[model samples]
Target: MRGRQLRRAEICLLVTVAAVPVAACGSERETVERPTVPRGMDRQADSDADRLAAEKAALDAYAGYLAASRAASGRSDPHAPELSRFLADPLLTRVQMSILQAKEHGAMRTGTLKSDPTVTSVSLDSKPATVEIQDCLDATGYRLVYAKDRRVVPGSGGGRHLATATATRYPDGRWLISSGAAHQDQPC
Candidate 1:
């Protein structure tokens, strides 16, 4: 049960190694604005306090997702505990797979991922409430590196890019990041 956690500590010089993809990591994203109650969301239907609470909870979920992803990638551990706490299927499986691949290749992503995230919209009236967030992830500080030697992998430094995610409130009253995407090619 304890075989797969990758240590971020620098490795001995003699170990063989490879690089992980920088695209697999993101973190330290700050919320830029209070979520707007826009179309698909009824301001009259839900009280301001309720709407604000939902939005805040959703953003909190988004933050958790980023933090969890960052930790998992840094450790190259797909089964990181926080991943399950903040994310659901599809996205959950995707992130785990990314980290697993990095682990298999003897690499991991390490360093801070600076970002500015904003809640674009929220839909509390929808069956299971949801919030959409957009972000400019400045991953310039994040890098993919060989687990051994802690050397930065060539061509693996990151840059600011547009990213998006959907936070869904479940029947259990937990808000989770259900899905997300980073448009690596689209600089923000």
Candidate 2:
């Protein structure tokens, strides 16, 4: 019985020793490194990443514009300096004019103006990249308030507006809205 027990212990020790080489071989196979990207492919990947980053920046700028517009509705001055950071040229002028008109009529909006913008397309091949965005405006919670008595304006029910805007990226990597048009009573 003692000899048999000794033999079994010896067999177990041998088995463990034999398993070490098989485990080491498996780890060696796993340690093999993956192939590196080719030089041309690497450059292409960089370009793609840059393009995607620019697109995201443009979208962010558009969102900023929407926020500015919402805030402008509550202010007497529609051409707030903050709005200029996101808008440029003809579009800026148009928005400013509209805000001025509303102010002149003693109209101000209260509550939130929600906007959801979607980037339909982006073209970054040119110096000034162009981006097209579709925005869904929800003014359902917004209320038009009169400046004189702070009374809610009549027929001021909030509605949905669908708008398409075009933005241009400047040399300084800033994106600004160039033009935009909206249709009232449209489904978001």
Candidate 3:
């Protein structure tokens, strides 16, 4: 009995010692604020808090993407470099292509684009983890117009509509808008 007890104690000590370095080396996303959680519940608190942070960051990235797109569209700039800051490859390519088409048609987007976005789902366990967002997009104060004369383009729309997006976490720890869609048919 004494020998078994000593072996268990040694194992526990080894585990505690091994855990210290691993804890210290946790990834940035795992770094949560020191919460007021009770001693044993710290892990739960940390996970919940980290999830909330990821949600907020994803929404922020969505806003950044919109703001950057608007800024570029207002100038009819197809090659607007700012879009890269908030967007990743395939979507980036598609968005730039859309802007190029708009510029080619001599049109520009102008005015305000307001959005109320919520995190619809979070998949932290997925490879490259992602957060899904649903937004009630209010573009009533915004418009697409002919650049040369500043006249509203026919069929250019503004209203409350549904929009959805997926925000993916990059290896570098930045959340970026990876995919999205605006639902013109579904009024919000």
Candidate 4:
């Protein structure tokens, strides 16, 4: 019995000693070697990434331009000739229609009001762009007067209505206003 017990103790001690050496043999962190990339492959990857980034930037700029056009004042029918000159293609036509509608009938102010965004300046996508716009008119005076039933008649359109516009890059590489939105409460 004593001999057997001594043998078991020796085996445990040997295992513990072997385990200590094995654990100390390797580092806790693994060292990985980076693979070498071919020059042509690297260049191609970089170029593709750059192109993608440029496209993304152009799209973002287009969207922002449209947002501004919708929020800013729109062209006035009183100066229709001058406004029409700047208003080109389908985009301008839509703005004209919106202005006319505002002149004819009042707009609706729905629940959860969100004011339109005004774009300061739109850098055309290298010029020659296509643009589009969509918008809704509001009659509310921004909580100046409360009550849904309380109809606060809007004053005459001052002169120009702020328009939100979105320009998109056409196939020709020109930036055009693809969309626009405006509230024609007051003339501009």
Each candidate: what lDDT? 0.85, 0.83, 0.89, 0.46
Clashing pairs in 2: none
Best of the two (1, 2) by TM-score: 1
Clashes of 2: 0
lDDT of 3 by residue, 1-188 (tens): 99999999999999999778867877434555543446768778778998999999998999999999999888878678889889987788888988889899999899999999999999998999999999999999899989999899999979999999899999999999989899989999
Per-candidate TM vs. native?
A: 0.74, 0.73, 0.78, 0.31
Superposed model 1: Cα runs more than 4 Å off: 1-46
The true-versus-predicted C-alpha distance at residue 59 of model 2, in Å, is 1.8
The lDDT, on a scale of 0 to 1, for candidate 1 is: 0.85
Candidates sorted by lDDT, best first:
3, 1, 2, 4
* Stretches of candidate 2 exceeding 4 Å from the true structure: 1-35
Best by TM-score: 3
**lDDT of candidate 4 over 1-188, digit per residue (tens):** 99999999999999999777646855434222334567699778876675565445445554444333333223223225433323345766665565456434433222222334333443334455333333333423222111234353355222235446565566654444555555565433
Clashes per candidate, residues 3 or more apart or on different chains: 0, 0, 0, 39
RMSD (CA, angstroms), candidate 1: 27.2
Cα error, residue 125 of model 1, in Å, equals 1.5
Model 4 error, position 76 (Å): 7.2
